[model samples]
Target: MALSDDTMRGVNLGGWLVLERYIKPSLFTVPECFDKGLHDPDVCTNDVDDAYPQDQWTLTGLFKNKDDARKYLKDHWANFVKEDDIIRIKNAGLGYVRIPVGHWIMGDISPDEPYVDGEWGDFVRVVKLCRKHGIQVWVDLHTAPGSQNGFDNSGRTLPTPTGVGWSGNPENVDRTIKAVRDIAEGIKQEGIEDVVTGFGVLNEPFKGQNEAQVKDFDDRAYRAVREVLGEGTTVYIADMFDAERFNGFWDDEEHGNTVLDSHYYHVFAQTPRGFSPRQHIAYVCEKNSRDVNACCWKGGGAGGGTSVGLKRMIGEWSVSFDTLVCTKLDDVMDSYREGGEVLEFTRKIGEKRKKFLRNFAEAQMVAWESQDTGVSVGWFYWNFKMEGGAFAEWDYLRGVEEGWMPTLKAEEKAEHVFGRCEEIIFRTDDEMDIVHEFPPSDSVAPDWQAVEADDDVVVSHGESLLTKGSRERGDGIVLGFLSLVVFLLLGLGIAKKCCVRYFGGAGGKGGYQRVGEVGGVGEVA
Candidate 1:
């Protein structure tokens, strides 16, 4: 079945099926591997150290054989996000869960590949458990055949921060598509297709460097999955950090039931790190709001001609303000100092960090759910929960426990949060100006009097018959009528001049007119 029209408030099941060292540090710590100094021949064949297995590929090397690797991974998968976690998710009022899976979950890993086996069964078990709890699933192929982004989360940690190889290698791209198809087929065979209503073809594929290849893979992978899952399923294509570039990618008729998945994180960039807590909330309420509205489908036209854009979802986002938390908080504090704030001022506000984080989270929720700004579908937090419950900002369960994330149950509660923020940041016109550096054109309130006047009947001669009877009107009706006539005459004159200039006139060649010319009727060509 297709995803419900209701906003998809969900959380990502990160570090479960696909391993990320940062998410679950304990899983990567293998004292035996460090002590024995043994590496997996397939992945750790390089000069790199095997002691620190940054990704799933290298982590498998720590085990003696496939059986050992399977046992270890199976244990982690079974316990990481068990039935209780699913129950907790449902109780938290979230309707969907995005489970990130490695490409090897399809059991197509070659002998040369260091990834373990039997994750497919564990993945199915998680989906079935979610089904029982009345929750939808977004199966995300987080890792591709050859690390799509060369990031550790892609299940392969490269020796260096090199560019992606998945798009460059045709076989890798094909394998990735096969993996997508396998996932769809598995869901079908397991009879969990109803709950597994969404499928993310790839997570965070670097589109900027491999636009053509990525587009081709998206088309092929989309078709491959659809061939098995049919049209009811929602196929997600990652925006790859460039949302504007792929704004209307899935709007066409051929791409029905497709969603552009975009991940939004403010902490990664320098500009956001410099923002004050209030500025961060304002940025979401204003700048991010405008961008979301621009990217989302406005619902008028058919196929690629849709009025605004494609169906979009904030596939991942979090309340985290800083990029990373090192052992010493002081090391990162200076880097994230607010713009123009002295060290003393930064430290003062640091005391009330929890309150600011709560406000920021609420602002995001309000903006993501706002019809005026949010994505057409909805949003999912970056993660359901991190390993140790240390990263509260990225962990939904921790955020709720700490009172930073709202225990959102209904739409009414969302509105209340919005109202509360409005009272603090967007309450007054001036306050609104503070939030929006460049206010949207539509932000200005319309002139009701002028709007009502527009409804008056106007003759071809530029005379208006006052619709509001003159008997009931004041003596100033003559002045109003005269003013309207004068305005119409000037407008007509300007239109005629614009026509003459464009179609050739005394001006010769009708080159162009500046804004200063013809009473500012035309722009410079």
Candidate 2:
């Protein structure tokens, strides 16, 4: 089933279930800080000698041993996100929350670091709480076994940061599929299927692998997820930065209802590097719109399979910039210091900063809500909150409160934008093929050709007639070879007849032998 237009606006429950150093550095207890007599004030921050021992700053590195980490999670995981947070989400007018979780929560990665007895139970509570608040939940398996992304957010990092992830090992892929099955069934058993939208099988599975490996893993993992969830359950497959691979993967008849998830982050890539604050805003809005049109709303051609059942959603996006603007804003205006008092420059930049951020944020919302691109299910802001001296641009609620993010009133405009385009899949739940107005060109037509209802034989121009299962185009080489062979044989027969007629047929040998024998009689008789 397609997600309702009203329920698309969303935010991610980051830094709560998942422990990211960039999100909440205080959560990790470093020995260097202790030596300096500094301590994190939050009691929830686990105390340990070296949580990120060996430079592995992930949730798995939170404690010295598995037991300590499990005990800490058991005691404090619930507090990280509570009923109040759900209420906050509800009040923000956002209808969905994409919760990023690790495989460890379901006990996929164990013996090394295990979740305590009731650790998995905490997830159940979160879903129930969201349901209670009339909010939908998107369960994203962010960290797969062996670390799919090899990034800290996936809860593990490699010695060398090559993005070689779970795809490198077959067993890791199987374990992740098993974990996905367990989560899908667990949610259904708890009767949260209505509230829990779908399981994001593997988040960013093959970030840097070749396309073949990515598709191979995607096919296996998707089939595994569909088997567990059954038909009609919306399964989200991350494009792994390969959107083209997902072009028509889920459009097949047998595949269940699925949504392609693409994360649109403006800060990371090099294209938007030198844009002004306003240009950055315009670029993202335009890019976001173009991506949606290409993927879902606009059909390439009739030969292009109908994209009717296809749906796409931006699973993650942020309003932050990687430009000098963000650098200037970081560290409490430390970058703005030249001659004037630092505090004065900080205040001056802060005021101007709000306007830049507000415009940037609104441009994204408008582009996302624009008639052409608004076809997306909805956009999920990168995060609900971040604890480090994190910039406010990354925080959804902070941006909203400071007039940077659009208010609920402005966000409601997306619901009406649907009318501008023809009715999309969201309006109907029927499982029918969606046809584009412009039929696909002949070159791209599906393998099967269409025939008139009354015609007994299907006639194709310069193509042979085909039976129920026959090849569409017949072989011309064999026919041409037979014609050539027959013509050559006839010419040879004619030549033989002519030679016999010209030399007096059977008597030709007697007539020519006497003349030659007279001259050579002396040599031979």
Candidate 3:
């Protein structure tokens, strides 16, 4: 089970094993709670709060007995995603599906916790279905004992949005590690290692608040999982939304088959608030592309690093670019209404928005899959399918149906689509001149300041104007001189040993090893 060179184009199986209110609203709708105005006094203390539940914790609390809750969730799990969905995914040419699971999947949580008894059986059945369809699986621990990010997606939504309790508690971290161990062992016992090739220890621990604790938890969880599954299985850890800081965190000799999972979403932040359709596509093609390239390149020149530079994948991203759909609010749906007008008006732009989304999706695919940038493992859309296609931007199946997203068969001929952003950026003749600008302006003309003359030193305007050109010539001369020196050393056999040591030749430290090699696990299956 060595790391595959082929890029993984996959979709996330969200809101299936894990409950997300927005993904499937029907599950959160309790008729008695809404009609009779029943509410959990512990969670809903104010009159302004909704009578309905907000997360799995409160949703399960509405059940009078454990059996009722188990039966209800089991039914939802059985019907929400089935063999037909797997068949559809296989037909679409997606080879991987990242399944998010709660910490209670193994039924190891305390009785007091407001979660279903177990969903491990259902989880296994889904994996078996994927195996039948010849698709790979990446199991993700999307929730922790306590709320990881204090969001409903983490299985709980706290009273305050930023009230994180997972990392602050040592017991909770230990429990999460045990859950990872159990999951790894479960996959082994089920004998599906060939299909379930990757495991994500935890998903999106609030990095700004729990940097040190999250790193510690990741280290512990990686060791715990490796002890059971070995290096043959790829272990993924979230970049904590800071890929630059975590790019080379696990590139040491001890760690192998490790990947950094980075999630990209343009709608959540304020930077893309006022961007036009073309600006959104340009942003992904330029800035986002550079960032992904930086994360993919580990150390030194291309192919001169150890063990195939720590792999990276865009684990979660969506086609949504609307700023109105903010996730910061306690109730995300409330942001859709503003000044007595529904925000759906923005989406009513009809064909224009659809065309923009199509181009945006293709631009993202081109930037992410470009070989000149770096070796990207692959990307997975945030969700496979929304419940009713209410939010088409976030639904991969709907995007395909609406003629925006490219199916796997379409991606096979992606060369035509890869040039889409280039056309948009250079649509006009003036736009071509802008690309050739040495120092591109950031929406403003460059300012030039003249320095005052000194008695000992003379300053000239012409020399100042040539500052950039002079520097470029100087760098070229230095590079050429160094090249000649290297050529002479190699011709004389003086730098052979040094080059071998630096580039990690055979019998050298930091050399790349295939699976089942000296530093790897058993033979690749």
Candidate 4:
């Protein structure tokens, strides 16, 4: 009933799990007869062999079709969900794993063509393993039938959360919602109902969020699921979209089991206004200010449980470091999170960044635990399993850093793997202990490299994360009203001040005073 801490922090499979990280700009279009028209607007619409503009789609990985996408996942995606990792994950004594799945994946029961009977089969295996290890699975349908995020992240284009300009076709929406419902039904009929703890309807349903429409769509989707799986399925709906900004919806009162979920990031509050990575390499993320609007409705944060009593989960989050991956090129993150020269290369965001982020991330978890969102509950870190070093199409890492693959070491695994509680604890739950394993190098040199381009010699989403790899992945939300009017004191690191008068608050109305070395603009007029 009470979502535990382990459930609160979990990892994502990323890249291989479902979506392609990013594509080479040059591969605009491939083959002689392929329909280049189906190309995503976000991707450079050009010849496959031609190069695309790098900056535009660098963050989003492109995919030709679902098969190509799944193949990479099946071959390269290894089990990072190890016993030790699980043991570490549950260190906080939590109970669930929020697994992000591409809604693009559908069975012939799939309308988008070529649906595999077991598209999510391997993932299911991982889920069952987690269940056996005492981890519950929160199936996050990260993207919808069409791409939720049109950028490279969606893995495709045409249909994205932005809606790509369709005639407010209720029919189209129904069809799309049905596709997802079918998947839910499949998931239920597959005999793995208990393995799935909850279902995240659509990730960042942000673009076309019409409060009435979104509510209708969600209600319809829920009904469809019941049509197949029957009653009692817990559903999760994320509110990144401005549509149906209402907190009116949460649990299926009629059926009575659901969770209203939301995601967050602190990049905005951490960065100063007019601040761009002009001096430093450009680094950015979804704006948190927009997220504030996305997440907070009068009763969204702490207390106010009646207006929105559906359980919410901030599924993913991390302190993003404007970092370049490891120079070693082989074992990058091996030394990033805690130590090494990489730490110095992190972000220009500064110590204020760290203090602000740590406090921000920690507070959300604590609030979600103590505050009565009655509307939401628990969370999963944006990601956990960043072990992307599979070689020869099947090789994978042992841990985030260490090279001990969990598949071969099942006997040694436990409830918490790669202990997040030990690694990053905002507030400990006295009942648990956490620990993490960061290897000394990026990875053991794979027998071979799955190089898409011999010239670039890219790896894992072509990020070469090992070399110039990123230190942060985004997801998670901080619920606080104070953050709205106050500005982070960049110079003082942790000092927060009222933004109303900037220099005159705290001292009587318009009183100008001098205290010690500090000057105040207010004078008791």
TM-score of each: 0.71, 0.67, 0.73, 0.54
lDDT comparing candidate 2 with the true structure: 0.53
Best first by lDDT, ranked = 3, 1, 2, 4
Q: Candidate 2 — which pairs collide?
A: 301-440, 302-439, 302-440, 303-440
On TM-score, the stronger of 3 and 4 is: 3
Worst 10 residues of 4 by lDDT: 277-286
- Expressed as tens digits, the lDDT of each residue in 230-312 for candidate 2 is 66467777877645556665565455456778876655443333233433543443335455545543243322543554567
Tens-digit per-residue lDDT, 230-249, candidate 1: 98898888876666666556
Clashing pairs in 3: none
lDDT of 2 at 299: 44
Per candidate, the number of residue pairs that clash is 0, 4, 0, 79
Q: Give residue 96's lDDT in candidate 3 (0 to 100).
A: 91
Pitting candidate 2 against candidate 4, the one with the higher TM-score is: 2
| lDDT tens digits by residue: candidate 4, 183-202 | 78767767777777577666
Q: What is the lDDT of residue 286 in candidate 1?
A: 44
| Winner on lDDT (1 vs 4) | 1
lDDT of 1: 0.63
Q: How far is 38's C-alpha from truth in model 1 (Å)?
A: 13
**445, model 3: CA deviation in Å?**
30
What is the clash tally of candidate 1? 0
